[model samples]
Target chain A: MLKDKKNYKLIVVEDNIGDFILFEEYLNEKIENPTLFHFERFKDLNDFQDKITPDFDIIFLDLSLPDKNGLDLIIEVQKISKQIPIIVLTGYSDESFATTSLALGISDYLLKDDLNSTTLYKSIIYNIERNKNLVKIRESEQLYSDLFQLSPLPICVYDIETLLFIDVNEAAVNLYGHSHSEFLNLKVDDIFHDEEIDKTEEIASKIMTHKKKNGEIIFVDSRSNTITFNGKKAKIILSNDITKSLNHIREIELQNQKLKEIAWKQSHIVRVPLSQILGLTQLILDDKETTQETKELIIILNNSAKELDKIIQEIITKSKEISLNE
Target chain B: MKHLFIIDDDAVSVLILKKMLSNADFLETPMVFYNGNEALNFFSKNYTSVDTYCVFLDINMPVMNGWEFLDNIQTTIHPNNFMVYLLTSSTSEYEKSKSNDYHCIKKFISKPISKEILNEIKEVFNSI
Candidate 1:
């Protein structure tokens, strides 16, 4: 089959010699562009598992294999790969048998008596297509689950508007310290500061206003606008815990407040001494209004006053260092 | 002359609504109530008149909710004379759908009624 074509590989796990020949003739006579294999017992699965890479598109299963009878071996075969579609071919065609087969992830079931070459061919191709879709769906679920688990940002999806938490990721559970069930029970008020939550309707408005998960308002200067937590809208929220970033901002703000205080002192308190000096110099010049010696002394006093003014100006100008000190 | 009623718990919100509606010449004068029960009581006493066309209702007011007021008025008074518009800050989608469950409520308007929404009110009244 590999030498003639590059297509799906099929595994037939039927113990009956007659049924094995029938599967072969169906592929050879009824199926076109198909590759086939037949087995008498469950050992062939292990044998094939060792001899070749397990990449069969379909596993045509018989419930009564020589050694492995009933639904157990079909499940064992199913564990191989959900992508490898297992269609059970059974003489025992009952609802219970079909139910068990389906519960065990057998893609479909076929009755051996009704197994014409056409039915076999159609079943093989149909199972192959079903297997492809199953694989695709599984891949997508895994990919999304991977993102939900590993993404750095905390994310959760809830029903829209009901705000009932539907699905939550590991990051969301970690950030909010909530289990999936616990998150489902919470409302918009549970996470926020109670006084702040007096205005929860406002937060919902903000969420609706900035539909992007990233838009934020300063909660405390140290707060990030973008933490997604439990909202009752049954909305999905993806929040990144920026509490650390917010803390850094608060530290800087406290520092800035300190600097602004220093700047105020320099502007007013520090300049008070210069004003006293200017007053003293004016009074001295006023006391001896017309002497040349007094005039020289006044010039000296003026220069000292200017120096004091410059010092005050420099303190005011440089207090902006509070910004850099952060 | 058209008479409107203001049902709000917050004094400031009711004051603003009254002052704004008066300035807009939207009514002769809107009667004000600080809670849903007071407004329902006023309606019980005054339901015989047909001039009250609008009730600017706050949903979270004490004594009774906006939904309860609608329910009470159904048995206690005829709603043919007045239409209630829910101007609330609640963004709950459940609340939006549940409002449809009440037969007397014409529409649920969200909070902080901007100029566009108040203008829509005028359009609804002018057609009458």
Candidate 2:
């Protein structure tokens, strides 16, 4: 009979000729003009492992091969065709072992006694589609995990109920001075100052103090949100260190106070001597016993003192304005 | 009608001011105190009259400063009993502006107290 053409490349690993013939007959009923590759020994499939370009759509593996059988054979075949869906056909009727094989990454497990065309066809189609979805889910999960782990800011995930740390990024480890294993042993309260830990649950973001592993307290700007982590209700915290900025502001305020004190002294101290000069010069000038030339010299001296006083006044006035602004 | 007073530590400043007051024909002998503490002490002991006194109060003094004297006097006597004129060689705009905070401080006078200033003071008291 001329087989109808519905091209699908398939691989079958079987030591038994009888089972091989039966599987081919069953596949022929469903698939038309299928390219089927058969390997009698497990070692024979290993020879063709590097030869295949893309891969076969499905692999029917007989667990009881000449060299390798059961879980070991499934593992070996799975290593070569990591992305391809694998179905295990075995003569053993042990349902427990069949279940064990499925857990070990085999897509489907069928006994040779119960194998039929319809059952064989259905297992191949369903498992291939299922494997595709699983691969997509795994890739997406990797993408999200990479985003969290590789973040630049210090971040951590902690269980909401237990308040225990579930995971922390590299940045968090370096910032808090705690190793990954050490952090796993710590609760959320361990990093926060005693008074501030209670507020973490109440507020989403705030500036607060935190303690590092070395028992140093630092100011931090913390932002947090609730999220599901490893199937547990947890909170993710992103914190930025602000200790340096706070210290900078404190330094500026201290400098401003010092400057104000200097200005106040300038306005007061300089005037003491200037007052003496003015008072003395005026007394000398108003004296009737003084000559005209001596009086002119005293007047010039008085003008110089007054000019110096004006400059000091301008400084005091500017400093006062600065103090008022503060 | 106003009484005249001079509160200054400098004897030369006191002499010059007293002469200016005599020239201005101020009738009273013009009560004098060397420093802010002495001035505050005099006011504490004496009965302050209803009539205002024109006081040429010097700023920088040994016992107590002008600002301290003003603070003490605010609680001790009525604000209207004194017409305070702050006298200083300091051309500081800061202290000048600060004088406005005391309502009793009528004027900020930078020394040397000339005849024109004495006449201005006379006119101000006469007008009041």
**Top candidate when judged by DockQ against the true structure:** 2
lDDT of 2 at A27: 85
Candidate 2, residues B1-128: lDDT per residue as tens digits?
56788988878678777866776777767888888889898888873667768889989888898888999887776657678999886667768899999998988988766667778888877766
DockQ of 2: 0.33
Clashing pairs in 2: none
The prediction achieving the highest TM-score against the true structure is 2
* Interface RMSD, per-candidate values to 1 decimal: 24.6, 2.9
Candidate 1 Cα errors over 4 Å, as ranges = A1-8, A31-37, A50-55, A92-96, A140-153, A156-166, A179-253, A281-298, A311-326, B1-128
- Clashing residue pairs in candidate 1 are A159-A234, A161-A233, A162-A233, A162-A234, A163-A232, A163-A233, A163-A234, A164-A234, A222-A246
lDDT of each candidate versus the true structure? 0.65, 0.82
TM-score computed on alpha carbons, candidate 1: 0.53
Could you report the DockQ of all the candidates, in the order they appear?
A: 0.01, 0.33
